[model samples]
Target: MGFWSTLFGGGSPQEKAARIAAKAEARAQREAEELAEKAAKTDGLFERALGKDPENCSYDARQKAAIKLVLANETAKGREAWLSISRDYPNELAHALEQVGVCYHLEKNYRAALENYEAAIRVGADAGHLADNMAEARKGMAAIG
Candidate 1:
């Protein structure tokens, strides 16, 4: 049933449809305002899940921001996150070493990209994806320059 028909249909025929419409409109307005308020909230104040372990968490505000940035596909922000965490976390450092290659690749810096990719491998990244990435960077270096 239509919204108005559900609430106002059962009412007396004398019930003005205008009043029901006004009430619905007011309710919609209130809900919209509530959504807007929630959207305005700053996520900077919250810590999300831990990557390695749920109990292992990021207490650093910058790291938290970087996570949000990575989630949001902000590559520059992702790079910043890598920069901040690589210094502290060995795993993150290895990952960041790979990301350095990625950043260089994005900028078309083939030599730099290859160097970082190799460094990531040297740093103990044996992941198949890393191998594939290194190969791709090598191909790019050969083709582009």
Candidate 2:
């Protein structure tokens, strides 16, 4: 009966299910390709901003690159860049700590986020600017607990 129905131009139930599954597979493949392309573009931009030797790059250039990476949703790379800055330029430690906290917050690691935020405050980052971020991390921690 299903074969006869299919021959008559009405797809059988199995055929309809297969068609839906094929469409879903195709959509998933396209989405994966798009994500890969986006990641490649972000890497290119990060390299351009930071240059080949990021360690030797000017502080401003490294900071710009780190900011770009973070804004592009590459939080781990951004955090590393910020850490390098803090290590090489002690004067910028407070700001770098705060940015690292933000990256941790974005990653949903609330405990790490809070710790970095506190360290930033201790290092003289403006408390007023960090207050909102600290509160949000605390809220997230509370929700989890």
Candidate 3:
């Protein structure tokens, strides 16, 4: 079962919160394990992807591996890589920016996330998701400010 399933399974109020925290811990452990696995393979596939034309060559697979690098590599490298994908591939820019937005949100930088999401919308991103994310971000911004 997924984290949400484990957390929200039938329970009393206190039991529910405990389950949620435990589920979060388990998910963190799983993510850490996956990050470790990706780090082991990064030296090869990650380097091979660098300086390569991702257009016809398929950036989809390459981009995913690069995303994993954010956890292992310094912030500059990950931001640089993401920026490259976004700039060089206008066709893929929206998604790339969306990914960056997610990275910022993960880091608790809501303003940056909203900015990136707005950029994605301006670039004709998946409209449905953009709208929903925009609403959520606005709610967050309102709450904080």
lDDT values, one for every candidate: 0.64, 0.86, 0.70
| Ranking 2 against 3 by lDDT, winner | 2
- Candidate 1 C-alpha error for residue 82, in Å: 0.7
lDDT by residue for model 1 over 22-138, one digit each (tens)? 899999999999877644432331222223334544535445655555555455545655665676576666667787677666666778777888888788866676777777778
lDDT tens per residue, model 3, 26-65:
9999999998886666654455334363452357655765
- Candidate 2 TM-score to native: 0.69
Q: Per-residue lDDT of 39-61 in model 2, one digit per residue for the tens?
A: 88777656644444546478887
- Which is the leading candidate under lDDT? 2
23 Cα displacement, candidate 1 (Å): 35
Model 3: weakest 10-residue lDDT segment is 48-57
- List the candidates ranked by lDDT, beginning with the highest: 2, 3, 1
Candidate 3 clash pair list: none
